[model samples]
Target: MSTIERKTVVLTGASGGIGMATAKALTERGFEVIAVVRDPSRVRDVGAVFQADLANLADVVRVGRELAEKVPRIDVLINNAGLHAFSQRTTVDGLPVMVAVNHVAPFLLTHALLPKLRASRGRIVHVASDAHRRVTTLSLPDDLVRTAQFSARESSFLYAQSKLLGVLFTKALARRLNGTGVVANSCCPGLNVTGLGRESRTFAALAKVLAAVGAFSPASGARIVVRLAADPESGSTSGTHFSRDGSVKVDTTLVANVALQEQLWAETARLPAVSSLGDFR
Candidate 1:
């Protein structure tokens, strides 16, 4: 009898609603779940949980190196951690918090663990959003790192722009990993009563109302992520955005621009958080 080998998935934000749901579903399916959480004390019943603040690049680099050193092999990486805000704020690293967590941190971590992913012929699933379509214009690489004064409404647009970057990053990463058997894709899990908007009381109240009135459950919202991460058919579905119906579509016109994607990749490589690590590009 041939023994079956359990597949391992590294998931960020595994302590939250959608993430906790993904962890449960994967474990039940016999996948070893390695959770990258903001607080280990809040995480339970995963294979292993490593705590790190995604808003901080130094911590991201530290944890990425640790995973690369210790995890041996990774069959999938789910960049599910994210944040939304009604106000603009910068991190200690001098980058916008939304941009740092939603895009750059995942980019750095994925690159740092590229070797393990390649060894396993793994998949990369970014938890992006359809919100990207809401963005009207972006200044490219410049808008990625710089944040200026903006109203609450403008902040929402800024958040949308950050998610747009995630979509673009997925496409760019897929291009970079071509012929390497390490595929990358992204999905927009429909809004659920998650902690993504805890920064604002109004949004939190609105989310509760939406959840009560038939918003998708965290488990249901997690379906797209689970599919993109573990579905055999999804292994080859790179450089696309998946909706709730499993339909493939471009997240936005900006994400579809190859030139913009390449520019984003090059500029992302130049980010202080990534470039300071030396030659990961």
Candidate 2:
């Protein structure tokens, strides 16, 4: 089968695991892979790499402007950078670390790149997770940002909620990009033993056990994202969620209420991190 030529893809979280695997896979397949990462020294052999810490909103803006100036167009944007913090932490902008890293940073980056993406008729792939289903409620209280108390269990729940917000953000962005050539979709990569949890020793051991038991490898986990970015058929699919196998998947509660999604979008927009982006359509 013939493949697309000169395709450009910007992927966050490329320092390791699924992100690193995806960067290699895409580059080997003839796509120009731009690896967005925080530590440049850790990345090796990626086609092109940029360093930016997504936890900082100012860095997000600076990186966005720098990327826009450097790249003429972006054929695909993969919002794969994420954090699974086991404690409460805040960014320089004062937003929760999980929320900032997982959602707001990608939101700002994608918004800043929209014009370039539209010019290339690009696709957006958000590496969300089925863990979103674990979030008991979508409402984030005003004090949620202020409270610093957190346990590992509570942090897991918050991380899941951040992923849920990613799903909603994808939906809202798709609607906003309607009539443009850009398409947006989110997906769950299934359980993967990709060393994504190296931050905690317990998680690292669990990741190893999961790998032994047949949880997908990082390469397998990245397949859906690669497919969404490079497969011609995916050009027509937008505003939907998918599983690792590329099948449509949705949380029933999330799909049932467009109003909730919109409200979430508005609320997220009001977040200081996102609001500071300055008129992102």
Candidate 3:
């Protein structure tokens, strides 16, 4: 039997929970791991660690450039960084915090690294969630970037909308990269007990309680992500959304809108920082 050589993977959101666990799991399998995090001090071990706050487009550009300069090729790129805000917030770029962090940043980073990924015939894994089913609409109003007063219900709804965008983006990206020897797919990690809910004490408590009952461990939740990144079976699968167990999952109706996906791709490309990167597709 021939032993397959492990490949290099670039993973974001590595300072905590699912991302942290996934980093360790990939390392254990002998893959070269380039873990990206907001806080460099928080990462304990990895092949390499890069720091950048995903909410900032400039920071995303900086991190992308830095990675491009240092790493010659990337076999896999995992877009795992995310934020669940209980209230509305805006970034320095004036975009809604959750949308910027969960979608735009990942979009920019992935596009910026596409050349290297293409060179290696890499795969891109986007971590999505079932919560996206709750998003009934996809609207990017003129003032959508502004932070507005939000009820608890509205906050969750908006968060789901962001995840839905992720699913749509993954599909669109896969199509754009077709026949390039690169594949992109999205997956839901399920309800894992992660610090993602750190903003709410109640949520944190509930996560801890559920984790105690074996609802899901960060390690277990990270399996699909690791599998997609390393498993040979997934090499040819692109534009599909998957569940925790590696089964196919359909995106919500709102997310399945191809027109909306193209609109988002064009609008995202219009962003000053994103535009500066030149033609990514």
User: Which candidate should be chosen as best, given TM-score against the real structure?
Assistant: 1
Better of 2 and 3 by TM-score: 3
Which window of 10 residues has the lowest lDDT sum in candidate 1? 1-10
Model 3, global lDDT:
0.86
Estimate the TM-score of every prediction: 0.95, 0.92, 0.93
Query: Which sections of candidate 1 miss by over 4 Å?
Result: 1-4, 211-214
Candidate 1: give its CA RMSD in angstroms. Answer: 1.8
Residue-wise C-alpha lDDT for candidate 3, range 1-281, written one tens digit per residue? 12366688999999888999999998888888898899999997888899999988889988998998898678999999999999888788878889899888889899779999999999999998878887776675432355787866677788887888788889899999999999999999988989988887788899989888987789999999999998889999999989998887566677788888888787777765457656543
Residue by residue across 98-213, what tens digits does model 2's lDDT show? 88888888888987788889998899999998888776666554522654768886877888888888888898889888889889999988777775567678999998887788
Ranking 1 against 3 by TM-score, winner: 1
Q: What global local distance difference test value does model 1 have? A: 0.87
Pairs of colliding residues, candidate 1: none
Q: Sum up the clashes in candidate 3.
A: 0
Candidate 2, backbone clash total: 0
What TM-score does prediction 1 earn? 0.95
